[model samples]
Target: MSISSRSDKKGGFRRVRFIILAISVFYLAFLQSSVMTFNTAYVVLSNETSSPLFNQYQLGATAALLNMNQFDWSPTYLPLALHRFPLDGLQRSFTFAASFAGGLLGTFPMLYVLKHVGAHVTMSIVGIASCILCALTPVTIAASFELFVGFLAAPIFPVIGTVIEDWAPMEEKGLFVAILSAHVELDTLFTPPVGSLIAEKVNWPTVFYVQALVCAFFTVGWMYFYRDDPGEHFMITRDEVDMIHRGKTKDHLMSPPYRAIFTSLSIWAVFISAIGTIFVGQFMDVFSPQYFTSVLGYSPTITGTLTIIPTIALLPLKAIAGIASDKITRISELAKLRIFNSLACFLGAAFFVVIILVPPSTNSAAATALIMMPFILLAFLSGGFHKAAVMISRQHSSFVYSIVHIFSMLALICSTFTIPLLTPEETFEQWRIVFIIFIAVLTISNIFFIIFVKAEPAEWAHVSNTNEFVQLTEEPRPKHQLRQ
Candidate 1:
């Protein structure tokens, strides 16, 4: 039977164990984006004096130092340590940037840990630490815990790399990666509405506690449910394992090919592609709360409700894109990657441009419709670099995708710094500049991807045999494996 026929048959999902594994990843992803950014931004700006309308606090004093015009730099610019960062947006953004920097610095070491120690252990450590961090976040003004969490969470994509290589069937790689990565995003989708409701009906501090409990549950379950090797999974059947391993071999490299991977034009394409994707992602997930509240002038509940619309629309679209990429077997893997990658970037670029033109108005629904389109097009990425990262590098995928994670962290840091600085007033015109910057970055990124991306394994990685389950070893690049 053809690959398309098998894809139609629901290749990976037919197995029960893969279903459980996928669910675990979904919960793991849920922890990725904190609800505090969305639910707390409004509260931070609240004060009795300067902004009475936004003041939701019990205390008279604790209003944000960040104002309508620029950062209200108070006191002397001392190099001395302050116990608490100002309860202001600019300070908040700086700490957030620092956390991403922590992640950036921690990426390669975390990558090494995930490659050697196993994802199950790394994830469990994250879950445990996050529980402590989430609980303390409500009280601590210093973002030290968040920085540590960022370091641990830095391994997420590499973990996905492990999942893709371990369980995903060769032909069905796109489908497996798309669904799994989207599952990881399930948190970002639900956080807006759920976090909003929790903040409104209950309280914001409770949000942290709830997430802590979630962390505890995830930690225990992950330790029990996930395994470094699928064969170690007590519930997984031999037949399903065989199916996943079809046209794939299980081989471990003592060390990654650093020189080849870094030098390869394709890997650079993945890195560039990630920066583009992450710029949009950071904007949508982290900065959009500020956009909706400060620029669009929406309430916390309204902002959450509005954001969920685009996110809710993302899952099915991503699923469709993944399925389509798999079923369309007529196209080469490289062709499919280029087509789908271009589709994602171009579609997103178009939507972003539309949003800037329309701006926000009294017609809330229209404004929402305009804003949501760009975020919705994030689904098209399932067929884009997400899969390309795995296809191009194969077994070295964990290491390769770590490059994505590294660049993604840097993008987060840059966005944290740049977006806050750019939109000091948080006006629509200021935001238009930010969105336009993303459009240009995304377009240029796609051009690089089109030029350099390859779906086949790189010649240097040394596992080019087309036979089923052929083992790989470290060796020099071959003439056949060379990019044509």
Candidate 2:
């Protein structure tokens, strides 16, 4: 065959590969939207268990100090008891310190397991272990230890992205990425309301039990259906596999160049922006109801019903922003995406800050109405900006997301603990300060993005040449320039 005919054949195969992967991704997306919510709601409910994973150690130590029985203490009792428990700083530090230490040590083992066993297998293991751990332990104790479980489970999404990249073609990359991220958005959006409903009728432990059953089902399904690569799956033809081999010159992904990747100002901006959204986002996840009850004086039922509105806004926003990004640039431009993301975050942050500044004595209905608008706005825009961030770094999605998420989550853990420490349990003022700081940091990140990021790949960049089946290292072009 002539060279041109061979090229045409390869292109045709690439298109076929893209379609198959897109179908798989959408299937996962639909499943994940339901499953992710169950998974997270279970974690939150587990936090109240006797041996909860993340906060269990802290609760255990405190219980030990107070000489209190886990069963006798209500959820309300523990917090009240802790307030009077004394040496507040030291106690809180121990909780955070132990969890952080465990996280650092646990990550190695987690990565090792994932690398050896693969994503589906490793996720199954963690899910099973966490469920058993929840069942055996008390609510308070379970809360403490669940943090470690969260850390261990962290790598699953990055692994999923890698699987998508290896098996999926260029045309479907954005949509697949959005599908994977949809798991996160759905988890955040739907889980809390579900948990609240459970908490209203039954005790919290049931949350984990239900979650455990669901995960067990998913584990079986995953093992049966999830092939790691296109080459392994029967649905992919040999012709398609060969084309993927040709198109992905950097076939086996390597560790990205840390220096160049990290030094990019856009990365810093993305990281800071993610953190900013996470602060407010955490409140929505963990404390929004507490805020509703304590600050706005709403009943749990009212809070539960109303709370879902912001997340409802987020779901469609995420889908629209992702589709828009894909439509605008066949290949993502970091500079353009960054600016758009920054603007969205900026608006979100501004609204959240305004809500925070309302005086402590504001009437409950008025406060709820005031904060609700900002909450919806921030949630929508935050979700939108986050999707764009993924698009812009399409080539390095897995590694970039992992690094950014690690830092963002660390900051998130710190913020979760700090807001309670700073504010009176019944007050909202301290949380306001958290939002202010979050907004300021993101604003600075946006400035860096505006000044330093470029619209195209850079000179020192590595380009995968579909036509040649090799990495093309060309002469240094102007900063942020891509070959035509």
Candidate 3:
């Protein structure tokens, strides 16, 4: 081919690759939302039905004896019964606990799979398996069985780090990581209302069926288009491959320095802060709907609607934070991360206090606004630490991410069990205690990150004179500048 022809082809291929990767990121976002939505809906349904089920039958005994489809299972059953069944907070908490525990159990195996098979394959498998598991949700006779299936689907979110490390350019790393991290908020933005509407209008089973179909579609697209490295992609031209590899010295495929990683205080800072952040977030995920309906006297639809405000506020704020972290070249990367991460947590803690001060009997709009402001502040503030994680361990970003994920999952599990224990009566007073605990956790974790987290690559991650490891200190030039 002529030089001009080759250049045109490479440009075209790069665009296609970019488009494919964008779609994949969004799909992963959707999947994350779907899982959370499924769990949220399950908790809502369990709360809605618990009293009626308990009133009518010995549910613990009946649950054991019944088959998957025996308990009046149908797409329409849940929607129709939403008004009929009464709320039970304890039951909801237990269901959340079970799902989180299942996720915790699934984390290690997911790490192993991601290491051996690579992210694209692992994610594709996870997508299909999650879809099947979601389809089985309505008929899940036992909570234990539901937990087991949830465990199977648990690896979806952590793998995004691998995808970003593989596809995103070094200069744009912060932006891409921020965008990918925002998937959680993106999921939050759409899933709650959509899931709630489906549960209310169509029925709960239909929700899972719909989610399954969406998952299958995306999974197929991902399997066909995603390549772990640019060189492996058939459509990628030589120029595009060179462009992708240009600033790179690191062998991203190398085995991680396990001891160095485990002993790193910076990693531990990220880990603990993630646990705190995720714990608070998961608490809201599982309980916020219940709180809206039970304590605040809002209907289910209104509760779902109210939650969207915080999610909407998060999107732009998160994008700004991500962009700022990338653009502020004067500051040390570690300093930038510390500032953003600590500020986000501290602000989030302040908002927790605001939430606690607002009486449950306060105007619903005011309450919603108070709850949302903190999330908005937090949305912009919290993701820099995640960007730092990638900076410190480019080759092992996924592995490092999995470690953070495990702690986050553990936090979710702890919240599931402890929230119920603290809020046994499900009163405003009980919830106040929960908020106080979150505030303390967030504050302490933020302090720890400020004190210990470093943005520089760990010493063990560096290549010796004899090796070909990528140098950590090299600044990545923009792609356009590089070719010029």
Candidate 4:
């Protein structure tokens, strides 16, 4: 074929592959959304249940200790007899902590699974396991079992990082990561209200059953439709395969530079930023519904609906950040990342302050809107950071990203413990202190990220013995000479 014709064919194939991968990534996001929705709603459902298994006074006391504002010490009536599970403040904290622990435990195992089984198979296995666990949650009737399910689902996330690194073109990495990261907010958009309605009208158990069934269908779909590498996909045209082979780094499968990665300052900055981000994010996920119910006096349904506001606002901001990051790559990658990160943190911190200053008794609509503002603004920072991790070490992206995620899980565990300690009584006044702490952490982390984090690939990432970094400008090798 002529050079021009070949180039045209490659371009067409690249577009096709991009679309397929994007859709697949979005599907993965859906699975993630389902699991996170369950986690987010679990605490709310457990708290609303009036079971003899739990002590209302103990919960009251803990809430009082953590939240010094006026709280109703009276027990709520359970709509169903089966709804009697004891989930006092301390117990709730422990349950959330267990889930975080599970996620942390799955990190190393995810790396091994991704390398051996490949992203598609690994995601399929984890997806099915998590679905089964969700289906069984109502029957199991124990928080411990729920925690185990969280652990199983935890590895699914790191695998996504691997897939992105392996498949996404370098130029469009930000956009791809943005779409994947936005799934969390997307879940927040629909799942909270839907899950809440199920918990309210029918029962919490029904929510799990429905999620399980949906997950099962998707799990099978992924197995049949998705492939780790485009070259292996039956549906991909030869032209598409050639495009992928030409674009990807040869060193992708080589042994990772563990020593260099571990010692890198940029990696550490990403870790610290993740810690700050996840700490606040988990606090919202695990406790925001409780906050609306206990402090703002909203019903479960209203709380669920209200949670969607921040999520809706966040989605577009993440897309904007992602697009902007990709478009501004002519600037230093580090500069783009730092600019977004610092802006997000500063603006998010300001919003948090506004949330804190707004009294709970202010107009309910206004108060809720103010409370959601920080989450929406902060979403930009979270999305940008994910893209930054990809840029810093594309070959070892999964491992680096997983390390940050594992630490974030640790932060989640710590937040579960500390949140209750800070606002034992579930009062807006007590929650103010929590928001202030969030602002401080975000500010500090952003400052550190701006000062230290670099977006260039790590030295070790380019130093593999068997394979070398592929330059974007390098000439494509003869198809026969390409590694299959």
Candidate 5:
């Protein structure tokens, strides 16, 4: 049967599926959290145990400092002190960057599958594969390779967006986006301790196995219950259907123009603002458990459990910030909204820097508290900044978001590679230096947003109501177009 015919005939069933998908995505978010948290904890634990280099940290450190001049920094050959590849450090760093880069590159294929095979089909395939990979991979070292799997999974968001757009009206994208953030809360809050315990006792591999099990359940449930759009689902009540259609009819006709949105100053601000937050966020995601355990001398279990605090804070903040963004839609108020949010980034980064400055003589509790403060504040600021981005993103959301993600990924790569190279060792001093540099980068990025980003009152509707949205829709650039 034709696609449209399928959609037409399955209206009742589709509504049912929509309700299921909505719930499933939220659950999937939690699963994503678990997978990632486990991956991080596993890597740290695995390396501490299996990697001879970490095992030999004290001997290597004493030897290096005592015979400082004799050590080789050259990349041409492996260093003699390391048991694995001298480039093990380099490999680890690059792997982190590569996973993100791989994900970004993989977005194209997922996007293609979404358009051709359909969103549900594409997500199902990717989700199930990711679960299996997590379950079967050997060692955290091998499992790290699954980071690419997660990267490929990134495009699922846009696919979800497409379906959500069809189900929700245009005016309510902000709400839809906020709803999506709830999944983030689940992931961020629940995974840390659970993953830590799994890593602490059973080792890291079980984390992946657990994730696989959850994904399996979700996959079966999604296939059995979810549909592509509300129009395709049977479970939606008449009232819900009327509400959804009303939304589409009222704002549906006003799809924004790509060029206008692409060129808008507000779009740039929204994009950069997001990049600022992500740079710090990635640091927390990738390095937190290690930083807590290795640097702060906390046990793995404590480190894992503590990581959830910031994410927990984000749940309420996300809701409030989203509502605030809607209220601050006027151009006159844009400056305050953006600045306030950006200030949060600035302060969060600043607090992180402060943690580095604290003397080593300070109590461990004090140090941990300092470190946790920045994370909490960053989470709070993230809500505001992200909400603002969504309110403005409506004009050119797809491309703008893609660009923002691209830059964020670029930052991720830079931080991953440069920090390790500059430090060359995992000493507390080296961490201090890296933290200082991160503070500088985060501050500068946010400052750039403040100086350049502008707010426009009618930015979202300009393309859709005028000829812009339709024109761009008709003649989208190949790279920007959804592939079939």
Candidate 6:
């Protein structure tokens, strides 16, 4: 093909890839967020009459930070609020933990299924299962169904990682990884406010029903439109497929070296960073709706609107950072990862610390900005440890990514249960302690990431055959600029 012709074909396929990624990522993320936002109504649900989905789901803790339940211990302590119990941080954490139980189960299956069934098939099966689970959540087994719904999330992104690794041009691989990751925040953008609206206007059950319908629409659209191989896609031209292959392709996947993966400090860095990311990320994402409604005294509708706005701002910011990371390739990918990860971790901790000190406020915009700034800073992870995992693992990227998700799952469990225990009164003083602990976790995790993070592929990421696939291309640099 002529140079101009190849260029044209390349641009066309890149556009197609982006569009497909967007459709697939947004829908899948939306599905996962739909599962998560069930907790948005946790306080409301728990306070209502007991059921399998609500009070029955919360069997243990009764005291919340400053609620009247605290007086059972102290005679002199003044109650901050008069709220009923069984919905304290511990209960909330356990409910959050249920999803991880499914994640842990699905991770091993993901490896097996992708090795055999293909990405499109795995994603389709997961999507359908999620929708079914969401639909079934109205029954007395809602919590169980919700747990099953979590299984859908486990393999979905790993499959997406494999597909993106196959199609994204070499120069744009990191950009694609980061861009696709926007789904993490994207789902949050929708679920909090939208879920709250449905829960308020209709009922909590209606929220799941709406999610089921949306999930079905996206799932079917993906099943119809996506093909396992670029060459097999009917909508794509042969030139487009060729262009994708010509740019970057992973024609074979190898069995990952488990010992290397487990022993590598670089891999541990990514996993550890994931723990901090999920802990701090969910600290705001999962619990904020409840916090705004309970502690800050906002209605659920207002809380939803306020909570999602930061994420809306974060999406474009994350994309911009991704593009910038891809465009500014001279710095070395390892350096870039450290810089971005540090900014995310330290700045997020800084924001959280500031919020702990922030006096109570009623002004919606200003208060929301202060509250959500830490969340907005999470945009850096796309350029940081997230992209690093992909770069470092390559052919075994799915397993590495799955490990990151597993770390995130474990961190979320700790974060979920930890906060409630620290701030049972939900008082500002108790919140200070919570923020301090989170900040410490963030700082310590960043330290390890900066110390051990790697950008080049690990020894275990070798291809099955000598397929001559392209390694990630960084912009040309001086010989000394390369790290060992």
After superposition, the stretches of candidate 6 with alpha carbons farther than 4 Å from their true spots are 1-14, 37-96, 246-252, 293-300, 356-368, 462-465, 469-484
The backbone clash count of each candidate, in order, is: 0, 29, 2, 10, 20, 6
lDDT of 4 by residue, 1-484 (tens): 1222222223323455565555565566557665555554565455633333344434576673454223332335533324535456777656656666767777787778777777778888888887878777664555576567657766655765776776666666777777777756665655566776676667667788777777777778778867766655555554655445454466666667788888888887888887888788876667888888998889976776776667777788887888788887477787888878876778878888888877878777787777777677766774457777877777788777778767876786788779989998888889999999999999998888878788777777653444433322355657654433
Give one digit per residue, the lDDT tens place, for model 3 in 391-413. 77766787888777778777877
CA RMSD for every model? 9.1, 9.8, 6.9, 7.2, 9.4, 10.3
Of candidate 2, the 10-residue stretch with the lowest lDDT total is 1-10
Question: Which segments of candidate 4 are over 4 A away from where they belong?
Answer: 1-14, 19-23, 33-95, 237-247, 293-300, 357-366, 463-484
Candidate 1 regions exceeding 4 Å error are 1-14, 34-91, 136-141, 293-300, 356-367, 464-484
> Which stretches in model 5 have alpha-carbon errors above 4 Å?
1-98, 139-148, 167-175, 182-185, 188-192, 203-205, 245-264, 293-295, 324-336, 353-364, 380-385, 422-436, 451-484
Best by lDDT: 6
Query: 4 or 6: which has the higher lDDT?
Result: 6
- Most accurate candidate by TM-score: 4
What lDDT does each candidate get?
0.69, 0.52, 0.69, 0.69, 0.56, 0.70
lDDT of 6 by residue, 1-484 (tens): 1122212122234356766777777776776775675665554355533222333344455533234333232123523121223456655655666777888777878767876787788888888888877776654324455577677778766765786676666567767877788777777766766776776666666777788888889999888877766655655553455556653435445567789899999989998988887887886776786777766778966775777777788888888888788889579888999988888899988887777777566454555677788778889888898788877777677777777777777787777678878878776677778778878988999999999998887767644444653221323334343221
- Regions of candidate 2 where Cα sits further than 4 Å from its true position: 1-105, 112-121, 131-148, 189-191, 195-204, 237-247, 329-335, 353-396, 425-432, 454-461, 464-484
- Write model 1 residue lDDT over 157-207, tens digit each, in one string: 777888788777776777877787785458765554556556556655566
Error of 4 at 329 (Å): 4.8
Residue-level lDDT tens digits of model 2 in 112-191: 56555666567556656655654443344432564554554555545545555565455444454555555555555434
Lowest summed lDDT over 10 consecutive residues: which window, candidate 3? 1-10
- Evaluated against the true structure, the overall lDDT of model 5 is 0.56
List TM-scores for all candidates, in order: 0.80, 0.68, 0.80, 0.81, 0.69, 0.80
